[model samples]
Target chain A: EDQVTQSPEALRLQEGESSSLNCSYTVSGLRGLFWYRQDPGKGPEFLFTLYSAGEEKEKERLKATLTKKESFLHITAPKPEDSATYLCAVQAGAGANSKLTFGKGITLSVRP
Target chain B: EAGVTQFPSHSVIEKGQTVTLRCDPISGHDNLYWYRRVMGKEIKFLLHFVKESKQDESGMPNNRFLAERTGGTYSTLKVQPAELEDSGVYFCASSRSSNQPQHFGDGTRLSIL
Candidate 1:
């Protein structure tokens, strides 16, 4: 079965605080792993997509690294504006139309 | 580019009533998807449409839900005889292709009485 689990269901950080969120997944054939940030009352916003283990991508204060069994979203020097629910999803096939299997998500609260 | 758009950001209806939700994907985006997040549950895939064709609807819960994309343009999801279980946030997303990152709209919050 394909499953995505995220740890520390909620996290709070002070300004300039650095931390990392974990997303572990189990799937038959991993095609892609995605990271998204969602604000209250709005839909999710795309962050990064990792295709293979050892691959990494960075944007502003955020960095995403992937391994065979899990992925980490590193938040360096976060600000209150960065508060949101971060979601992790996995696509389990090579087919172009594979549906995403999403985790429950980790809510992040960054205090200024 | 204009992001995906959904109508009636919120809706409240009685049981057994029919409610229709609409989604307008970014222009020229060929892949559109429907997802639902029920209260206290993970967001689940409902179906996918490539242009005007239904590519994969295996995730659709039952026959009461019907989705259509006429003229390979905007799409609509109709829930007939809506049940209490159908109450949730319905999200619409689109991308240039299925393999691309999907952009989402502010979901429609549906409440059933």
Candidate 2:
């Protein structure tokens, strides 16, 4: 079974604090890893897609890096508006269904 | 272009009642997906539709849930005899291709009594 696990169920950070959210996965074969940001009462918004180990993508204050077994989403100098639940998901390449298996998400609270 | 849209931003109903959620995919998007997040849980896939045909429905919880994508433009998901466990946020997403990234809607929050 393909499973995705996220650590630090909840995190509180002060303004300008930097941290990383972890997403560990065990899949038959990873086709792609995805990162999404979800606010309360809203759906998830796409952030990045990592296809291979050593690959990294960045946007604004957020950066995403992928490894062979896990991925990290690093937030630099986060603000109150950046507070949201960060989700990680993995897709298996060999499956007839391309449905993604998602982590429970890390709830980030940035106090300003 | 407009993003995926879901109707009835929120719904409240009693157990055993029927509720229907609707989704409008982005123009030209061929792949539509349905997912839901139960309380304190991860988002789980419910189904996927390619045009007017269901590409996969393995994630569907049970026979009580029925989904349709008639005419290949809009889709609807109906839950009959809803259970208390069905209370959650239902999300709709669409992608131009099956392998590409998907765009999501604001989601509809369902509360069962």
Candidate 3:
């Protein structure tokens, strides 16, 4: 079974602080790795999709980087509004088997 | 474009009662998915629909859950005789294609007492 494990189940940071969240995975053949941000009582919002190792994507203060075995979401100078649960999911195989196996998620709280 | 939307932002019910959740995917999206996040657990895929067809449903926990996407425009998931363990957030997501990024709705929070 494809599995995703996210580190630091809960994190607290001061406004403008920078840190990175880690996601480690094991799959038969990784088709894609996804990053999502979820707020309290809300569904997850897509962030980035990493298809191959050494690939990276950025949006505002968030930068997502991937490797063969893990992925990292780096938040640069985060604001209080950035507080949310960061989810990491992995899709294995292809075609109709596009289901995503998600991790438990990392809860981030940024204090102003 | 409008994002995916789900009805009943919150629902509270007693055990053994039936509840039906609805979802309206973004226009032009062909792939619809159902997922659930139980408390203290990861979000898990329940099933997927492609243009009104059941493409994959390997993750469905049991026969108590039934999902349908008639006409391929909207979808519904019904849980009969709901159990206490069924309390959680049920989310709906849609994608343009199989490999595209899936967009999610705000989710329906179900609480069984």
Candidate 4:
């Protein structure tokens, strides 16, 4: 079974503090690794998609990097507005039914 | 251009009642998907549709759930005789292509009493 596990179920950070969230996975063939940010009552918003190992993508203050067995979401100088649940998902290239298997998510609380 | 849209932002119903959720994907998007998240569990995929055809319904929990995407524009998911275990947030997403990033909607929160 394809599985995604995210560590540090909850994290509290001070303003300007930098940290990284971990997401480990096990799948047959990884087609894509996705990163999303979800607010309390809203749907997840797409952040990045990593296809291969050693690939990295970044936004304003968030960066996502993928490896052979895990992925990391690095937060640089995070702000209060960046506080949300960060989700990690992986899609297997197994077949047409290759839907995403999401992690339980890491709840980030950035105190300003 | 509009992103994916779903109706009934919140729904509260009694057990055994049927509920139908609707989703209108962005114009020209061919891949539509349905997902659900229980209270404290991770979000799980329910089904997927490519245009008007059901590409994969393997994630569907049981036969009580029925999904249809007609005319390849809008989709509906109906749960008959709903149970308390089915209470959760139902999310709808759409992607222009198979391997593209999907756009999501502010899911509908379903509560069963």
Comparison by lDDT, 1 against 3, better one:
3
The Cα error of candidate 3 at residue B5, in Å, is: 0.8
Q: Whose lDDT is greatest here? A: 3
DockQ of each: 0.78, 0.76, 0.90, 0.81
DockQ of 3: 0.90
Rank candidates, DockQ, best first: 3, 4, 1, 2
Q: Which regions in candidate 2 have their CA more than 4 angstroms from the true location? A: none
Least accurate 10 contiguous residues by lDDT in model 1 chain A: A91-100
**Tens digits of per-residue lDDT for model 3, B34-100:** 9999988999999999999999999888999999999999999999989999999999999999899
Return whichever of 2 and 3 wins on DockQ.
3
Residue-by-residue lDDT tens digits, candidate 4, A1-112: 9999999999999999999999999999999999999999999999999999999999999999999999999999999999999999999976675588999999999999
Writing each residue's lDDT as its tens digit, candidate 1 over A14-102 gives 99999999999999999899999999999999999999999999999999999999999999999999999999999886566568889
Using DockQ as the measure, the top candidate is 3
**lDDT tens digits, residue span B19-99, model 1:** 999999999999999999998888889999999999999889999999999998999999998999999999999989887
Q: For residues B46-107, could you state the per-residue lDDT of candidate 4 as single tens digits?
A: 99999999999889999999999999999999999999999999999999887888889999
**lDDT by residue (tens digit), candidate 2, B25-113:** 99999889999999888899999999999989989999999999999999999999899999999999998887788889999999999
Q: Model 1: DockQ against the native?
A: 0.78
Sliding window of 10 residues with minimal summed lDDT for model 4 chain B? B96-105
Mind giving the per-residue lDDT tens digits that candidate 2 earns over A1-102?
Answer: 899999999999999999999999998888899999999888889999999999999999999999999999999999999999999999886645678789
TM for chain B in all models?
0.99, 0.99, 0.99, 0.98
Tell me the docking grade of candidate 2.
medium
